[model samples]
Target: MDVLVLIGRILFAALFLASAAGHLTRTKMMAGYAASKGVPAAVPATIGSGLLILVGGLSILLGIWADLGALLLVVFLVPTAVLMHGFWKESDPQTRQLEMVQFQKDLALAGAALVLLALIAHAGTDLGLTITGPVFDIN
Candidate 1:
């Protein structure tokens, strides 16, 4: 069961880790895209989000501060979905459909982050854990 949990954490964190890599490696390109989407301070925002995603993904993967990791993901996912994938603002049918799909996917990821947060909260209560405690801390 613990092994399964570890695997789950890895799988969940993979997307964020990969995205962070992309964000950091393609800063100029991503920032340009964000600017086109009307994001203010696009370059800085991209860099910040990349760092947040990297930290959150690592925290979750290491089972350390998973709650904070989940919270960070929720923060990133919500705004990214709403601002970047605004299907409602699209007019082209094909583009609108694509954006809608991306929007749905982001929402789903956000939902997963929320669930992870809830699970972390429950574990904290049951194991008498604090924010500083590791998720698997049995002591």
Candidate 2:
């Protein structure tokens, strides 16, 4: 279980860090995309999103307050997956198909992040404090 968690952490960290860097390095492109998406304040939105990804990715990689990091990721990803990637539901059929595919891919990544968040949240809750199936100590 520990080894699996470690591996999962590494892969998740790598994925977020790479994407964070991509956004930070391409601020203009990101801002342009945001503006194209009809974001009211594209420049600030771009910078804020980039910072969120960078800081949240680093937090996850460091394994310090991972729950908080995951929460932050969820905050960013929900909007991104819904707004920026809403091309599927808002665009033409031809464009929608392509965009929907990309949206689903991004949604998958967001889903992974959400799962990690849930795991962290469950770690200390009554939810995580349960076991099922046969047990010798059952009485």
Candidate 3:
């Protein structure tokens, strides 16, 4: 399980790092795409998004602020999935299919991040330690 957690962290870090680098290196293209998506203040948003991705990715890679890093990623990617990938009517079927697949993958990754964040936040609580009470107890 520890190995699995480490693998997840590494894989997620790599994905974010690649995405951040892409966005940073392609600022103009990203801005254009954002404008096309009807985003207001597209240029600034693009730049800010890139920075958030870079920072969050680095945090994950360094294993520092893992919970906050995951939270930041969730904040960035959830709206991204919605605004960028949710609507598909304008796209060709093949493109839409691919985008949908990517969106699902992002959603899954975000869900995993959230789960990891929760676990990390509850670190002191015995994950396997059970507490008994009248009716509402945690185990």
Clashing pairs for predicted structure model 2, backbone only: none
Candidates arranged by TM-score, highest first: 1, 3, 2
Worst 10-residue lDDT window for candidate 1 reads 130-139
Please provide, for model 2 over 1-139, each residue's C-alpha lDDT reduced to its tens digit, 9 standing for 90 to 100.
6456556767777877777776778878888988887787887887788788777676666656565676678788878877787875665787787778777877787788777666655553322212221111111
lDDT by candidate, in order shown: 0.85, 0.68, 0.72
For candidate 1, the TM-score is 0.89
Provide the clashing-pair count of each candidate structure.
0, 0, 0
| Model 1 C-alpha lDDT per residue in residues 24-113, reported as the tens digit of each score | 999999999999999999999999999999999988887778877988999999999999999999999999999999999999999998
The CA-based lDDT of model 2 is what? 0.68
Best of the candidates, lDDT: 1
Stretches off by above 4 angstroms in model 2 are 88-91, 124-139
Error of 3 at 38 (Å): 1.5
Q: Per-prediction RMSD in angstroms?
A: 3.8, 7.4, 6.5
